[model samples]
Target: MSESYEKFEGLIPGDGHPRWGQSYYYNAYDPVRCLGVFIRLGFLENQGEANSWVIVFRNGSPLFTRTNLNLPHTLARPADGVEIAGMRIHAEVPLKRTRITFSSPDCSFDLVWSELHPLADCIAMTQDKDGAFAREVAHIHLEGTSTVTGSITHRGEMAALDGKGFRDIAAGPRNWDALLHYRLAWPVFDNGMAFCGIRGISTAGGSAYMRMMHDGEAWRRVTAIEDRLTFSPDGLAVEHAHWVFTDELGRRHEMTARPLFGWLFPFDTFVLREHMMEYRLADGTIGYGLHETGYRLPWQGMAD
Candidate 1:
């Protein structure tokens, strides 16, 4: 189905369910070698303050250990001229009993908790409609006695974390199930291109909605729930799907999404899911994006 499309005007109120207070994103890839990395940091308002964290999946496995503690709010821009907002965190992996550190001027941070799972594998793939790109799978066997540290900058915050020993098993699904409601749209690369999408359920009753931007210029909102879904799992040897977004403004956009890889943590009863998507405009120009989700629901408890 085709509709009149316009440039998305960034994130708007009442767009989709905002997952956190404000969302930050970064996606970089090497198209020639088919390798890429995608990262996202989400902030949520707790009481009168904002509590935020970072979620990154390198290749397909959880890149950094998950932490529930809130990092100190600070801003740091290193020599690279990258600005990050957040806190510096240090974590110890119980499994390998290793330490890692994450320091950055951006909004996110990274550290190696365990050398058991290393970031070495590189997958093959193409760019997305929004310029987002990534590898199909990362087969980096990070197992050993080692120390690694890295930092990420996003959403106007900076933070860092460091620790050693990989205590947690790197393989398995981590269940993250929570009902989220928010809207988001960001214009990067000098606003020459942009993309926006939303997924939320009503607070009162059975109201739910999802929408996306087509060319970083047009706004397409999906009104009918039944008409906003598309499933395709046979393209890249992985489960694939796309959703149709139609905004309240009568705009339309098509979003094609696929899982980069899946992670299941049987011990902790959690699942870490990562997906790469491509948004194609009516004119056929493409945009790329990465989505990382955590599912923790009642069904998970039953299985446990």
Candidate 2:
């Protein structure tokens, strides 16, 4: 697969399906400052709508958040940048390096993301082209771990941003109503090892759609994942977790996590609770990233 493909670089013109959509997402957090930033730009081409979200959190609560769930899809795709829904995502090196900027009354940030590892093709982890799990998610998914550096101004105070980050591009039909419940975790450790795993219950049954990792040397697809998570009293965020992953080469990796901060994101048919967590490997190296869970709206049933 070529990384320079148009679909990987920016928004596709249109795929004809009303449900077809594409999204560019990025996040980075500083453990010392207990601060985190997450940004997303989405385009629903067939529907002629766009969605953008910018959220910054201090300690454990949101300092500023700008959510534009629907806006006229007046998007501009420059040769090296993307402008949509009040945000500019400029790529200096396509998928390897990016500068994302946003400005609003309450908050603003200009952050640069540099990929530290090769992009992972999440769909390959499924090993099935026509599987039920693949159909429910999307047709394309690419992700990478990155190092973030820049600055953010929130409520009149500016702060330097230095932290490990994660970015991903997803496209195709994402039928939210197909999922009953799902959990997604992407953690990058201090030693350079990282994991991205997802498991869910869909109408067809249980499936693990994404299970891959960077072992500091190379990327490998994990054969199985066993995860146990405990949520907060309100069941809206993760409190603690224990995970075990079995790689294709037959090695067992284990880790545990405790939440540092959490935020809730709701859109369309799902409510997502994204947690910034501090994780400890069995050997005791600490790391940070996102632990997210998605639940379908109880009122919506599976596609018939």
Candidate 3:
């Protein structure tokens, strides 16, 4: 079957409403350690401001919260004092051909969208002393507007921002109307340490899909897996799967994916899920990184 791109309506509760948007990133190292960061950006219908904040999480829990700062920015680690931002940020997502120029007394930079694709978005810009880094952005578009305003309250923390907007979509309280986007890098060990790009999608109907770069190959749709999913007591989950991919060459490649870690988020309408799977050839050889899942997207301007 061809790759399915079915449209979903109200997949997210308050998509396209006037409110701040939040993006999160989580990184998991080989053995048994992981770190995550949550970013909140204010968005209005026709206005833009400098109100953005980021929260860090480690080992499936909260670590620290940084307010009024640029995202993917370096932060000091409390454990070893070693810089982890370099590994934490994979890529930057853009806001659909949008550009933002920021100027301060000591520094200034321009955020421009250099690439736009159906799977991921890239925003390119230069920071204070750093040369250039593209910010990869992703989000779950909601369906409606909110009634509250000023300082978004998420996970019991009050975020102060420069705009008047309500809860475009409820962030907490475990509602199901939410969408998710996950990005990660896959290292292909068999072919001279070659790496492939992988992404996942999660939607409302409990349906998910994974897209990845297949050794300079085109996008392929995975049909099924050979294993079951395992859940942890703390809500962490993992699984190993064998996927059957049909590529553009009209050939099928059977690859085994050993999941290193999984990230789970509770949504309003559905439970969002993502897993970092290590792809390997059927003969027990490492191939690439496979990030897979799906999410519901808010539907707008649709005719019945």
Candidate 3's C-alpha runs over 4 A off are 1-189, 192-212, 217-236, 266-274, 288-304
- Summarize candidate 3's per-residue lDDT along 22-84 as a digit string, tens digits: 322222222123332333332221223223433433444554544543334222221122123
Q: Find the candidate with the highest lDDT and give its number.
A: 2
| Runs with alpha carbons beyond 4 Å of true place in candidate 2 | 4-7, 75-79, 299-304
- Candidate 2 lDDT by residue in tens digits, 1-304: 3655434666565567677877788989988788788888777778888788878887888888778888777555423687765578887787788898878776788989988876777777657556654676667778789999898888789999889888888778767778877888889999999998877777556665677898899888888888888866666667788999988789899999998777777777787778888889899988899888887776343221
Which tens-of-lDDT digit does each residue in 90-123 have in candidate 1?
Answer: 2232222222223444334444433322221011
The local distance difference test score of each candidate is: 0.30, 0.78, 0.31
lDDT for position 173 in model 3? 19
- For residue 294, give model 1's deviation from the true position in Å: 5.6
Identify the runs in model 1 with alpha carbons over 4 angstroms from their true place: 1-68, 72-195, 202-205, 210-238, 246-255, 262-272, 278-286, 292-296, 300-304
Give TM per candidate.
Answer: 0.39, 0.92, 0.36
What lDDT, from 0 to 1, does candidate 2 have? 0.78
Cα lDDT over the full model 1: 0.30
